[model samples]
Target: MSRTRIVVVGDVLLDRDVEGTVDRVTPDAPAPVLDVTGVHASPGGAGLAALLAAGDGADVTLVAPIANDPDGRLLTEQVEVAAQVVPLGHAGRTRTKMRVRSGGHTLVRLDDGGPGTPTTVPGDVVAELVDAADVVLVSDYGGGVTRDAELRARLTPVAGRVVWDPHPRGAPPVPGVRLATPNVAEARAALEAHGRHADGCGGPAGPERVAARLRSAWGCAALAVTAGAAGAYLADGGQVRFAPTPGRADGDPCGAGDRFAVSAALALARGAGAAEAVEQAVVDATGWVRAGGTAALHHRPGPGTPRPPGRAGESLEALAARLRARGGRLVATGGCFDLLHAGHVAMLQTARTLGGSLVVLLNSDASVRALKGPDRPVQHAADRARVLRALGCVDEVVVFDGPDPAAALARLRPDVWVKGGDYDTSALPERFVVEGHGGSVVLLPYVPGQSTTAILARSATGPRPDLEVLR
Candidate 1:
């Protein structure tokens, strides 16, 4: 199969991170002293988007202004490891952002260097690169590259294949661009820049309104307003769709926007529609955050790295203890997964994201009969556990005997208790047990018009030949 060629255009920056630990306070001042442990440097801005695309196994080329300074050289070398660089020439010093962190938390960030405006744009070379690219992602970082007349001219012609990840100080997306991804705050600011009031964009439909207005204003074919952990809202012509995140992930989200833009560009290049691309991007971005965001890139688990229990033969208690020891939250959700349809899969997938690992408290055959009636549990407990464990999102499945999973939940003691929104949390017997132990309960939206009971009824009346009769 031919590789997807992705070209990233915009400004680049050098990112430096200083990791250390804080202990005793200085004698002269009240400030705590940090004994530095390590220092890491990498590319930021558009260069980050290029690296992300390249990491996804795409053929990536980054087109940006690069200075000959020390920081610029460092940024280019790191970026070049993952992508080819087409320097547009820089008029000023290379920009840099340095963050000091201790105990996985940032103490402070120091930004230095220059405005980093592009001095030269070889039109022919840029045109050639754009023409050859399957997708062009403009990752604007409020720098002068996106505003350059020569760069804009080259981008306008291929706007149909362009995905613009916008910045407040950067140029707006060229007309007819495929997609523009802006975080909710940036979207509001963009509207305000156009003499439109952002106050009108609020409530449950806030993101949808922002996306539609931005798409029309920027002249892009579609716009997706990302809301971080809440996922994104896409506006494609007259249609609007909200792609909610599966669940909350606890990790650094520094380069998640870059991750999102790269995923969307790759999806569109693979022939996915704008809405479909945004949906896939949301999932990809969430996973990036779950894996410790951009910081995880520096400290990836090697071949010999010990992994948490997702493999077979791991006990539920062992998995829970390991996750807790690593400061990872344990999420638990219970259900009588008799049929295991699309709805069940969706719910399970969402629950898994609520924490580091997911433990499914599956109802026993006897439990299902008591709660769902004698005709329930078409599949036996063993078969149900096998299917649940087979799901990539599910960590472990524990069969518990009872009408409710209250007794089992007391033993599991997950950090988060998840359930479908169809049920009332106040009425759930397991709620007290979960909250009493300092665990929180979350109710996720259920897929509309999908239920095991309904499926069984349909099966009894006129079962599809493709389906097996469990009874």
Candidate 2:
């Protein structure tokens, strides 16, 4: 699929995760002097919404404020993953939140920085990007990103297709937008501003009532109310559909709501039905945020190699079933990986990045020996499996005890087939097999010095390390 660019506008902030373990009480004034374990940073506010879009295969441009200060530097650094960032100078401080955690529970959170009103963004850039965007998402976090009337006026014209998480106090959008994604609270406010009957978070006119009213009030084609664990209320042409979130919605709800918004936008951009669209989004939201508070689109290099996008993966058949059911796509590749090196990681990452789940055709002990001769595959199959599983680019692992993974690929026909740069697509013996099932083949990057061959060469001249002893 070609790139689907999305423009996300509004508040952009930084999230500092201060994680630690608390063993004993603090010697300080009534505070737990917890032993800090580590810290991680993530993009918050609209930056997070942009992150979700980027993670879901959308070329996202974050059009938010960068105050041109130290905190602005942090916001800019945090949102470096986007395709383009529109910095709004003059807003002195970039909003930041530091959350203190203990035993996976957030004990306290201290917020730094404050909202700043954006004055301008490089010429008519906002309008141009909005016009070019396949989907536009408004993350009105009330962080002063969308406060300008002129900016809103310019942006409203190109709202042919937009998924808005509207700020409660922002001005009304331009007419003719396709969809508005709001929680129950913001829905009431937006709708009530147009003289409709609704209340924030859900009151007299709940989601169903507000969705119906907003469609006419703002000329929105559809409306979706993200009800958190109660799922979501989707309405189009006066018809309402309530899609419930998964059972695991009770998990860490840190940023899952933002994930749901972006995922829903992506699904709609892909032309999915409302319920189907929300289902995919909810899945992505709960899976990522519930697990690690990470946005869906991960950009980390594959095992420090030039791997594909979705390299780190899980079950193949299971993933395939989910994707097939929802029309999601996937890619697959195989390798011996007796020695995990950059080349192998790079190859797997690229394979997954092409799109969807990357099923690794693993070489069992016997298969590696058959292919690479004796004294190879020092690591046991189970140990190799664990190593391969650790890489984020690989989704599923299938161990073939004999040899040749074509039989395995035939069983699970992925949408795309990828191999390392060492071989041409023509030389892929199963290329036809994949094509027979309507799958395409591509060659991935080959990182030098990251090969088993290199390791073998180095070992020949010195004391060989028994890296496979763990297996």
Using lDDT as the measure, the top candidate is: 1
What tens-digit string does per-residue lDDT give for candidate 1 at 1-471?
999999999889888889887888999998879999999877889988887787777999999999998888888887877779998888778888898987667789998877888998999999999999999999999878889999999999999999999999998888999999999999999988987766653443377887888888888899999999888999998988999875554456888898889899999999999988998888778666655565555553342221211111234444465346445689999888898888888988998887888888989999999998878779999788767766778766678887788887887789999998578888999999999999999998878878898888886799666565663
Clashes of each: 0, 23
lDDT of 2 by residue, 227-340 (tens): 766667778885898876444322246776677777777877788876787767655654553334541122243322211122133234434553454334777777788888
Please state every model's RMSD to the true fold in angstroms.
10.4, 17.1
Error of 2 at 464 (Å): 65
465 in model 1: Cα distance from truth in Å? 27
lDDT of 2 at 85: 80
lDDT of each: 0.83, 0.70
TM-score of 1: 0.69
TM-scores of all candidate predictions against the true structure? 0.69, 0.61
Model 2 regions more than 4 Å off: 27-30, 188-206, 295-471
